[model samples]
Target: MKVLVTGGSGFIASWIRKELAARGHSVLVMDHQDRRQNLAPDEEFFLGDVRDATAVTEAAAHVDGIIHLAAVLGTQETISNPRPSAETNILGSLNVFEAAAQYGLPVVYAGVGNHAFRLVGTGCYTITKSAAEDLARMYNLYRDGGRITIVRPVNAYGPGQSIAKPYGTSKVRKILPALTCRALIGSPIEVYGDGTQISDCVYVEDVARAFVTALEHTAVNGPTEKPVEVGPLTSVTVNDIAAMVAGHAAAVTGRPVVDLVHLPMRPGEIPNAVVSSDTSTLQQIGMTAADFVPLAEGIRRTVDYYATQWLPGWLQGMQVSA
Candidate 1:
């Protein structure tokens, strides 16, 4: 199949593109960046944003299926600039759905952490993702024969994950990037609000494979209202993550042991962000425990990436804290 992948230049979609090629498929990517390196001969790029309906339609055309990964990402980033977030996450999703319905193409969408057990948070990112999920379900309902499978992945981390870059009105705050920035230099890892807030994180490759498997299987399963939860079986608190990354930094790079410094919780943040108790779709796709990179191994890999690829540039730009 030749798939149209929205947000194709983003971290997660980059992996999805690789998975597609591995599965004997080609991809046409629509994103803000041009990611031309190492693409399959048939794989193509459409440099555009999902917010542009005309561009989305143009990119959506002639694809066998659609993998909708584009969105205004980040909890705090979206909350800080709600208008653009709404335009992209909500309206951009609508454009994709409409195009899919018009073309009678199957859709595999990216959702936030599972809501089957409990909602992850009550921020703009959570609200907009939920709204988009609702819109997806509605599209499946109204459009006869329209199929849409949603994958709800927890905080995804791995090699290609970028550091906190300018995203919307606020800069992004990814756990691994921030922790890595400090841990690599033997500086204190900042932990907000006693560091007890829980989060379930998945490797980017595993998340990508989950999306590919869902796309390959959705035809057999049909569009289920219940999203496929993708992530680890275990949940870790912020404190746990801090310690693990710190240990990896020391072992992986000979960095000194790091400590955690507690800070006030950011506004609109949730205490716990975990996966649902329901059977994760990774299981449904027949991925055994062996398929997942163990948390330690994953962190070690991420640490290596930062220690080599990231830290060199980051060190040059890093301003000394006053």
Candidate 2:
């Protein structure tokens, strides 16, 4: 199958592209940025914004299926600038769905698993993502012939996951990468609120594998309306995450354990104790939490990867507060 992956340059998409290539499928990446290093030999690139219908249509023209992963992610960015967030995440997703509908191609849409649990605060990111999910359902219903498979992913983290570059004045806040980077430099690991908030973090490679599984599973496009929830079943608290990173940093670089600093929680943040996903749906796709990389191992691998690949540049930028 020749697959078109939107936002193929992203962390998770890069892994997914490799997974597809390994399965002997040709991939065409459509992204605003070029990441030729992540592309396979048989893969092609189409440079454009997903918000443009013509661009999306042109990119999807020759693909057997579509995996829609493009979006302006992160809570800080979405809340700080709601307009562009809505325009890109919501409208941009509409363009993808519309183009897929036009070409009668099957689409696999990525969603947030946090929406399945109780939410707190303003939820600007959730609002736009939820809107996009609704639009996908609408397209599936109205278009009558198109197949749209939705996969709700939990906190995905691993190597290659970096903080989004600063957008103007607001600094990007991604949990794992931030903690790991700070711990490596012996800086205090900042935990928002009481540091009790829990996340069901999944390894990037596992999440990427789930995307490919969903794309191949026929039941994903069946009569079910619920999106497949994919992630590690074990939940780890923010404090636990900080401790894990500190331990790994200490072991790797002979650094002392980093201190955990409590900070005020941001708006739209929720205290998640545990994550409950549809196990039946996951089993259907031949995945389970047991298939995930262990938390400690994943953290160590991430720290090592960043230490060699990203730590120097990150240290240069470390003068900025978390």
Candidate 3:
């Protein structure tokens, strides 16, 4: 199969691209920026944005299916600037759907599991993502046929994820990378609110497999049925995550301890929210929680990755080019 993956340079998309290529599928990556280093030799790349219909159409022309993953992420980033988030997540997604509809291509959309039930807060990131999911459903209903499959993934973490430069930067907001980096550098790990807000953190490789499965699955369609929830069957609180990161850091680097600093939760933050995998949907897709990487093990791998792989390359990039 020839698969077109939007935002192929992103963390999850990177894994999806590699997985598809490994499964003997030719991949065509379309992203606004060039992160060609993540691509395999058998994969092709196109510099394009999902917002541009022409670009999206050109990219989807010869692809057997589409995995739509391009969008502005981060709750803080989206809440801080809603316009661009709306433009990119909503309008940009519409362009992708329209193009896919034109080409009669099957689409596998990446959505947030949190929004699968009820949105606790009105964060722009969730709002725009939910809107895009609606657009995907609409396209499926009114277009050639219902050839869309929605995969709602929980908080996905792993190596190759983007992190703030200069190491230990406070601007790093993603939970996993932020905690991992702070623990490695002996900085206090910041936890928002009471540190009890629950999240289901799935490994990137697992999420990548779910996307590939959804793209190939012929039974997914329409918006009436619930989207397939991909993640661990259990949930962990924020405080639990902090402790896990600290423990993994200690184990990996032989550190004595790591401190947790409680901070007031930011605006648009959901309190007491928990995300869990829908077993029925997973069963339908022939997946189970046992197939996922254990949280503690995943955390340990992530800590090592940031400490060894990501941090060193970032520091090297900062060196003066003479």
Models 1 onward score TM values of: 0.90, 0.90, 0.91
lDDT of 3 by residue, 1-322 (tens): 8999998888798899878877888999999988777677888989998888899989888788899999887677777888887998899888888887787788888888778333457568888989888887777677775567788888899997777644644343667987888887677888888888887799989999888877877434423255778888677888998999988888777776689999887776766766666746866566777878999889988998887986565557657542
Candidate achieving the largest lDDT? 3
C-alpha lDDT of all candidate models, in order: 0.79, 0.78, 0.80
Candidate 3 segments whose C-alpha is farther than 4 A from its true place: 116-119, 165-172, 219-224, 311-322
Worst 10 residues of 1 by lDDT: 162-171
| Model 2 pairs whose backbones collide | none
Give the Cα error of residue 244 in candidate 3, in Å: 1.2
Superposed by TM-score, candidate 3 places the C-alpha of residue 220 at a distance from the truth, in angstroms, of 9.1
lDDT of 1 at 170: 26
Per residue, candidate 2 scores C-alpha lDDT tens digits across 70-131 of: 98877766777888778888999998888877877878889877764324454567688878
